[model samples]
Target: MTSPDARMLASQNIVLILCGNKKDLDADREVTFLEASRFAQENELMFLETSALTGENVEEAFMQCARKILNKIESGELDPERMGSGIQYGDAALRQLRSPRRTQAPSAQECGC
Candidate 1:
């Protein structure tokens, strides 16, 4: 059963990572690594076994997510201008909005006073 937030994020084409934490306590783990990995594969999500106690794969997990997002953006699969969440707006959005290549104005234009 997927959470409503997960469904919402999935609908937005967001890259998802299924991290199995507490690798340091592997012996006491109820969920086997193979099981988690298989589940992640079935769900088409990146999987990582992380340990907060030892900080194992913690950085790598985040890096993987970032890399996937960057790859999607570079490949034009993700459009920052069209996305409504999970992305920060700054110079890139402004540049895209004011770009000479942009032929159409935004759908909802508001003049901030």
Candidate 2:
């Protein structure tokens, strides 16, 4: 199920990262480093072992993903306006919806109250 999803995302030029987390508990690790690395290589995805507890490689992983996204954006490979791109630039309506001014209720005169 997940493999097909990954393939579909890959086909759509999405950046993928296969993360093996919990490096802080290396002794309790079930999946070996080699296995995870091999899987990531086979799937053509970037691999990282991160530890949220120790903050090891966590920032690197995010930076790598962000860099890839920025590269794609710069190269025009990824369009923020494209459907299914998981990004949306605010249109006028969307901007209005997000604007703080919209939070205020209309005055009684404006509402004809």
Candidate 3:
């Protein structure tokens, strides 16, 4: 990626993690975990790996990204009012308003009971 792209993404504080290829057993086709980790250390981004076939580490990767964003927010490092800010708690009044429940058909046993 170009410097401008990196800067733009960084300005938004979006966690950009590179997942390398699991196809190569030699582990040189793409960026490895070590390299991503180093990059994360330098750029203050969250780094992780995931496998699509086995469905491994995918959840962990998302959780790691969420935790990093939350940590930045908690530390006052990121402003929630910013456009790219991911911290959306929504309006309190919206939560207070409840949706109407749907009616369901009951079995014959319910009528006797």
* Top candidate by lDDT: 2
lDDT of 3 by residue, 1-113 (tens): 32557666556666555554353344554665677678767765555566776666777777877777666766666756557665554785643223333256667767634
Error of 2 at 45 (Å): 1.2
Query: All candidates' lDDT scores?
Result: 0.74, 0.75, 0.59
Per-residue CA lDDT of candidate 1, range 1-113, in tens? 23557856553767788888899997899998898888889877789999999999999999998887766666666666675645545775454532334346655675433
For model 3, the run of ten residues with the poorest summed lDDT: 94-103
Taking all chains together, the TM-score of candidate 1 against the true structure is 0.70
| Candidate 2 lDDT (Cα, 0 to 1) | 0.75
- The list of candidate 3 runs beyond 4 A from truth reads 1-3, 9-12, 21-36, 39-44, 82-87, 91-113
How does residue 27 of candidate 2 score in lDDT? 95
lDDT of 1: 0.74
Could you tell me which 10 consecutive residues in candidate 2 have the lowest summed lDDT?
94-103
lDDT of 2 by residue, 1-113 (tens): 03776666553776778878899998999999999988888877899999988899989998999888766766667766678776555675643322223347788768734
Candidate 2 Cα RMSD (Å) = 10.9
Q: Kindly state the number of residue pairs that clash in model 3.
A: 0
Best-to-worst ranking by TM-score: 1, 2, 3
The lDDT ranking, best first, is: 2, 1, 3
